[model samples]
Target: MYLTQGLHRSLQRHPDKPALRHVGDGDVRTHTFAELLRDTGQHAAALQARGVKAGDRVALLAPNHDRLVRALLACWWLGAVACPLNVRWSAPELAYAVSDSEASLLVVDEALAGLVRELPLPVIDFEQLAQEAQGLQALPDVRAGGDTLAAILYTGGTTGRSKGVMLSHANFWTASMTRGAELNNAPDSVSLLVAPLFHVAGLGRLVGQTLVGGTCVTMAHFKPAAVLEAIERHGISDVVVVPTMLQSLLDDPGFAPERVRSLNRIAFGAAPMPPDLLERALQAWPHAEFFQAYGLTETAGAVCINLPDNHRDPAALAQGRLNSVGRAGLGAEIQIVDESGRELPAGQVGQIIVRGPMVTRGYWRLPEASAEALRGGWLHTGDAGRMDAQGYLYIVDRLKDMIISGGENIYCAEVESVLRTHPLVSQAAVIGRPDPHWGEVVHAVLVLADGATAEQLPLPVLRDWCHERLAGYKCPRGLSHVPALPLSAAGKVLKTVLRQQLAA
Candidate 1:
């Protein structure tokens, strides 16, 4: 299916239907299906006027807003690829992706006009671009389908320079259908799209809602109070968030059951979901259905999702279902394979490999790296995970995050999960601290619960606590306290930064 297929259908079925809404610092804006299509067409014409053609790359650097949405649709309309740059990046980081994507034109939000230094290409303000096209000729949908490049979404460079994952129209549609089917996106649904569009989780949610002709409300930035306000004000029925975002929303001073009572679906993923935080969310939104998605930028969106039924089922929870990212969704295949590509047995932790229609073709212009990653006809996800007898996938941790301490392998997520179970620990991140004798030692960085302090748990106390739940060798040998962990745009803990902190 094409990315904008539903938009055309909606234009025919219900032209006046509300399609998008944006709430930005007291500025509220909206667009109907007809309005959305017209805006998209005009934006497409604007790009065309600037010499953008089918198959050309258009770099989009903006936060979540109506103009950003229109620009994305405009690119798709002209069969051009949209490369959304991360707003959280430094000038160098943003320039790297822009240069790598070999973008022909830069479409930017005026607010971030100064971020791209030594601007290399012709730039058009997103607002002026759309406003200029108001009465211009409406561009026809080029109908770029399977294998046609749609968007170039760069991965969050938590480790190093980010790689742009090339996804097609079919890839987005596949992810939209797969994740939406599991999340149950209805036409009447009003999704609060607060996630940064640069990330797949946020962009995928936008695609899913648009594909179903559902309305999505955008927030320029993610703020818990604004999320509650949007849910209450716009009657938002669905939302997508990471574990950290979910916790903030549940703990936000403005949060109340009634304010978000309109929410019927909540989808979370992109990072580990702490059990304690998940439990708190469940209690706060007993009326909502919860979905846990698991995938990477290469996989478009979620390849697997722990469904609402399993989330709310007592028997399933007792059976440790909450720990699962769920079985592979339709059109996707999940496998745990050893280094040699041999499939591992159930419950054996190994590299998680995925194959599916939603899988990205490869990284932009990095054939050798692409071949290595997409080796054996499967995307070798760097994540270390295992599958149970029932095909439920349990994410352990990133393979690179695994620590070898005194010749013993220790997965950080295992240690972090146990640490989060501690009553006083609100958040935990584990890393390997270089030790002269042991080579590497498990080091724990923790964020304590409200009214708690580092004084409550010293290094020895933490080691003793971990020792009770973990093997002696796996127990942390070092401990530090942080008010909050540095995170990438997608909400994954920034271990590289943590390493720098340790060195300092």
Candidate 2:
């Protein structure tokens, strides 16, 4: 089960098939399977010429595009590890990852040339490098095996600093295969590539589509109008989106069901979605199947996926499985366990642990942290959840997000849920702020509805509103109305920034 096996086979079976389509610099580009193979071969040769050998890490810091995909294939073709850094990260953050990975060669798109120059590694423009590499001879030993390290994706370190999650060929191969099988993917599927390829969710699918000989349409950045336009113009069959992106699409005024009639599947995961909005999406795009898959960088991309059957039946939701993340995927096991590592009974809320072939080998070189996360043969997911008798998983709040104030435990989601019920709130982010007496207190930052101001809407009134829904202790002690919350490119709230600003 080599990771590049499918691509290799595709070149033989359907060499002239449409492999990629990318929009960039005011032009649209398309490449066939044979063209992709030729470019990958040349890129591999160029990397080899530049001292990139087997086992060396070649980092790519770029957004979603044709070159990113080609570079990834080139790395696998040369048996070199591809370390894709998040393009949204600052120069310092990029340097940290490059140094940690000890990447010998750094590939950057022209837009990021300045950032790449600051790093100590040899910097190569992704487009120029691929073009130059195409001229070299293709080597026989470039294909990577199942056990070879394909990527070392760094997680957004919420607890401390980010750590690299080492993924083998098998891990990526399995993730792609499972995703295709779960969605009943076909060769003619036109998957949208709007999310940045640096993320496991985005890049994993990029590889998946190519492996299955499907066409990919790349968007440099996701714009609501552009996404809708692409769907109508290209007849996009499937799109992988996070909760926030999906919401934006559903919120668009031009979102006509007929405009996206060709869209058969919409796979959303990355972050938790507001249930109400998710329901609206289902209503708006009745023809498209909505599948919610749950995963983290540590598990390649997806560990569990809610199947089409579960999404179609609202009755299953009433029976205590309201759009719950479905059972574990193939080659995976999930369990709810207590602090002592003993498995809990069904319907009991506890820490969610996962064990699977796609789980990372370990956190890169941090033996202590690795041991802490991978205890008892299961990757401690740090997420809190419970499984029903029929094995549907319901996600609770994060363990750290649980607030303890005045000897009573309060979940922030419970408070946020009540606040969200108010029609005046546009968005709400709940966090535990430091308190001198209580050790910690609940803080709520909100984006208000039209014609509302933080000065006019005092903390007392908001507190009173929450009091009607939640208990006194759970009510936020402080409220700050903000125009916008700090968000990552993928649409997840940058809680770390919020926590820092509130701490200051």
Q: By lDDT, who's the top model here?
A: 1
CA lDDT of 419 in candidate 1?
95
What's the lDDT of the predicted structure labeled candidate 2?
A: 0.83
Residues 457-487 of candidate 1 have per-residue lDDT tens digits of 8888888888888998888888889999998
Alpha carbon lDDT at 424, candidate 1: 90
lDDT of 2 at 385: 86
RMSD of each: 1.2, 1.9
C-alpha-based local distance difference test score of model 1: 0.89
Per-residue lDDT of 273 in model 2: 62
Each prediction's whole-model lDDT (CA): 0.89, 0.83
Q: How big is the positional error of residue 425 in model 1, measured in Å on the Cα after superposition?
A: 2.3
TM-scores for every candidate against the unseen true structure:
0.98, 0.95
